[model samples]
Target: MIKEKAKKKWDLTRKMLEITDDEYNGVTQEDANLRFIKTKLQIAVYYLRMLDEHNCEYEVPWNKEQFKWLLRKPAGDTKKQKAKDWCHQCCLIRDKACASWSYEEATA
Candidate 1:
């Protein structure tokens, strides 16, 4: 049930990535892409959090290092730096979720 909900949210987010130019109004392409990336990160973190909540031991496809790299690479400009920081925050939250999952499993 949680997986299904996450999958639906993921699908909806992907669909949102296909919105038309007019849909963006005054937002630039770079900003739009950053928003998309942030949304994707949020979705990934949400699933990890859900996994922790359910005490699921399934492997997560992406690691904290990958998320850290994604968070740090695109920090060239102010806007990009904001996006990078946002990704970094997501990474921190995700790491906590995974760690909590591991701790719970170990203590169980």
Candidate 2:
């Protein structure tokens, strides 16, 4: 179930990024935004898959600092805040998935 959710998010983000790329007319801000989102989705998919396989030896794509940055407040703009909120939701899903794993055995 977690894998399927991650896959769906990745697929949707990829489609959005493609559309943004196709409509590119020298403006890069939108393209960059979508690219960032796509990257996050890709990482989520990877981590979720590894979790499904019970692979706990692998390191996370983002370190503690980077993940904290991803969830930080976006200055004072509503648009940026919305993006942060979406990222937080993604993190929650990944965190819940991680909690389902048996780390005790993996560490032993």
Candidate 3:
């Protein structure tokens, strides 16, 4: 049973992740945001499907650090600085993916 909330969330995520026909009918896996969003939705759907299979009520963690709303960014940082830092970090979910983000995590 797909809940209204889950359906909406999945729809939104899918739209953000997929490239439109106008966007170069040919796609590349090198697009980081597109790749990440695809992987994230896969995990979300996997968990939801697992819940259904087990007849369990799956509670999405709306407070996970992986989600932008739950992210803790440095205070007083400018958009340019943040964008630079994000590039430097490459949005690596793995702790040791980059030294700069690793340093940020350590200090934060």
Local accuracy by lDDT, each model: 0.53, 0.49, 0.40
**Clashes, model 1:** 0
Q: Model 3, which residues run further than 4 Å from truth?
A: 1-30, 63-108
Off by over 4 Å in 2: 1-10, 19-76, 102-108
Q: After superposition, how far is residue 63 of candidate 1 from its true place, in Å?
A: 25
TM-score for each prediction?
A: 0.41, 0.37, 0.32
- What is residue 73's positional error in candidate 2, in angstroms? 21
Comparing 2 and 3 on TM-score, the stronger one:
2
lDDT: which is higher, 1 or 3? Answer: 1
lDDT of 1 by residue, 26-95 (tens): 3666555555555556655565556545455545555556545544424235545544455566556666
Which is the leading candidate under lDDT? 1
Best by TM-score: 1
Write model 3 residue lDDT over 9-108, tens digit each, in one string: 4665445535545333435433433344444444545454434433344344432344443122221224234333433333232223222221234564
TM-score, candidate 2, is: 0.37
Weakest 10 consecutive residues, lDDT, candidate 1?
70-79
RMSD of each: 10.7, 10.2, 14.4
Candidate 2 residues 1-108, lDDT tens each? 455654564464345434344434434565445445545544554554555455333334555465445433331243344444554555665676687666565564
